[model samples]
Target: MIRPKLELADIFRAHGPAWRQANAGHVSLGQLKVMSAIEACRTETLGGHVAGCASCGHHHIAYNSCKNRHCPKCQGPAARDWMAARAEDLLPVEYFHVVVTLPAEIAQVAFWNKKAVYDLLFRASAETVMTIAADPRRMGAQVGMTSVLHTWGSALTHHPHIHMIVPGGGLSPDGTRWVPCRPGFFLHVRVLSRLFRRLFIEGLLALHRAGALSFFGDLAGLAEAGAFAAWLAPLRKSEWVVYAKPPFGGPEAVLAYLSRYTHRVAISNSRLVSADDATVAFRWKDYRIKRGDRQRIMRLATGEFIRRFLLHVLPDGFHRIRHYGLLASAGRKANIGKIRALLGQSPAIAPPEAGAEPVPLTLREPCPCCGGPMRVIEIFRRGQKPQSRAPPRDQAA
Candidate 1:
């Protein structure tokens, strides 16, 4: 039976042609291909081969997955794997959540230069935090943080913001001790906003000077350096928003938050309710409200849904996930080692866990109740339906 919370895969399986018609001119050819690939995931479109248990004379057919990061059907495993790698980075200190948002004036340029601007957003924000925290007059410590880029608002609109989960403390630059922030406070938002604005404008100017930004239609005038500089002039005087919320529930909550934000796209498939009659309904969270007041339901035309989702289509091969400061890629291993030494803890490593690796089909059949290994007793080939079997005890007996 079809359900309201069905995913894109289920939606397309139910109404592929109608969705295609609605999105024909709105979505990019590549996006359409992604949609098609998602539609065909775990189906016969990609073809499959049968596997059999020779001893038990049992078999089943397995289908192929699209594996596109944007495809809803594939993000689950991807998120899980990402979380597994990051789980060890958690520090034993209080963590804070800060969000730095872009002003409407820059949103236009950001839309065209997502990779560049977003990269700058991360850099500028990280630098702002480190600069403020390390000042002798301020927190005066090297602070470590993990930042996630969120490019959408609650309504699926393009409102770029970076959500950072930062530890309450950091290693002293000399790597001798961990310095913690004052209780209930991290860094000065006013100072952070100023630095963030300056850094971001500089990065944008660099991109513009290098001819890396694309302008079209109404924005064509911005192609000139004078016009671009003039546009940025007011932004310098205007304040950028750098908001810091209260400390999270220690390190655990911080990791939980990171696990959600780092992998988020414009929307998740689970939020989807239905796709029919050229409209799609879904759920969203309104972060501006009190607790228990955040969830809301919304609907949009199929074309608009596709448009919003595609708005977040990153430049190909751009690394959405990144590390900076202590987590910077170049010397992360050594840096982490040095940090652990200062904290009086060993360099972090993954601990063994059951089922950490993929479980094979053969390992799945040792029955817990019967203490016996079971094997597939029959083959279910492609295009061949499984025959009806004996009913459960309640119905058969």
Candidate 2:
């Protein structure tokens, strides 16, 4: 993909210092680190290397990536790498895409209690699916799924939701048979929504009662038990949104979907139209529309754009992607083998032997001057420019 003319780095490099100073005490360490990482990515603030193509004597300087998960510029390669690793996990079965969303009232609370609340969101949603699938009336089998947490909508709003990819079937209770769901249907969305709402609310109440939740600003009154209960009163009756898309065409579609989502950031550079000293303009999709064009451009004050972007910097050490049931790290491989055998399929090839040196992944990025690899020749440290002179254009081999 071609790089965008504008980038998050451009905005950060221009406005981040001022924004940080203006919000000094209010900003978080994690957010500040994200800003710093993005601003310095592929710049002299980080070290770089010199790449040369011997075939044509083509040479150029290349900077390093921050590899920060929140960096929009970095997620492309991260997503590719993640998808490559997950490719082997796909099964020869239809996969369903399920979305579980937290309502607005609860989202406000999640703003202050990110780690605690999002943790509950992950567990409650996963448990709801696993529990429902395991019931004799539903599928009566153990299902496996991968759940990814997305905290931003197209307009960069803080909308926390889980996008789960689940196989349309599972291992039987006795672990002897593979049970598939009814064609074109996984589970009842209304039933999933109700159960998910109940489980999440129960978890939230436990957090509140155990004093694990904190209140601030307009929510300060919720510090008291009665006030907290009152705040949560209407949520119990309201309908939560949970929906499942029809099963994917096959494993190829599953891989394609995972590549787009697994390592996604709050926004991508392609969505950015332009930015100036005072304001920023970007494209967004208006999901409220059901049948018409949803493409729209939104302009926001420069400061507000940065604020919205920073709203999604997850808590340090908090995992945004998770696996559950058969996909859970523990026993995942073993479970897959069992399911394969039950399906009359052979077990997957063995992974590399213990302590064997793994093969390195070589990038096929070719230099523009000639169709050849750009081999790294010299390394430079941070805050330093390249000392070696570039090969003259006339010096082509």
- lDDT winner: 2
Stretches off by above 4 angstroms in model 1 are 1-4, 12-26, 47-62, 286-292, 346-397
Give lDDT tens digits, candidate 1, residues 1-397. Answer: 1122477777655666666675567556766776678787766566544434434433344445678777766666677778877777766667888889999879888887787888888888889888888887887777767777778887889998888877787777677888888988888889889989998899889989999898877888999999989989999999899999999887567766776777776777778877775788889887878788788888987767766876777667777666767777776667667766777776687667776753344424333234344343433444554343422211221
TM-score of 2: 0.94
Q: CA RMSD for every model?
A: 5.2, 2.9
Model 2, 1-397: lDDT tens digits are: 3457899999999988898888999989999999999998977678877777758867766678899999987888889878877877778888999999999989999999999999999999999999999989999999989999999999999999999999999988988889999999998889899899999999999999899999999999999999998988998999899999989999999999988898888888889999998999999999999988999999999999999999999999999999999999998888888888888877767766666743332134667677776677778898777876764222322
- Candidate 2 has its poorest 10 consecutive residues by lDDT at 357-366
- For each candidate in the order shown, give its overall lDDT on alpha carbons: 0.73, 0.88
Clashing pairs in model 2, backbone N/Cα/C closer than 3 A:
none
Candidate 2 stretches greater than 4 Å from native: 350-363, 390-397
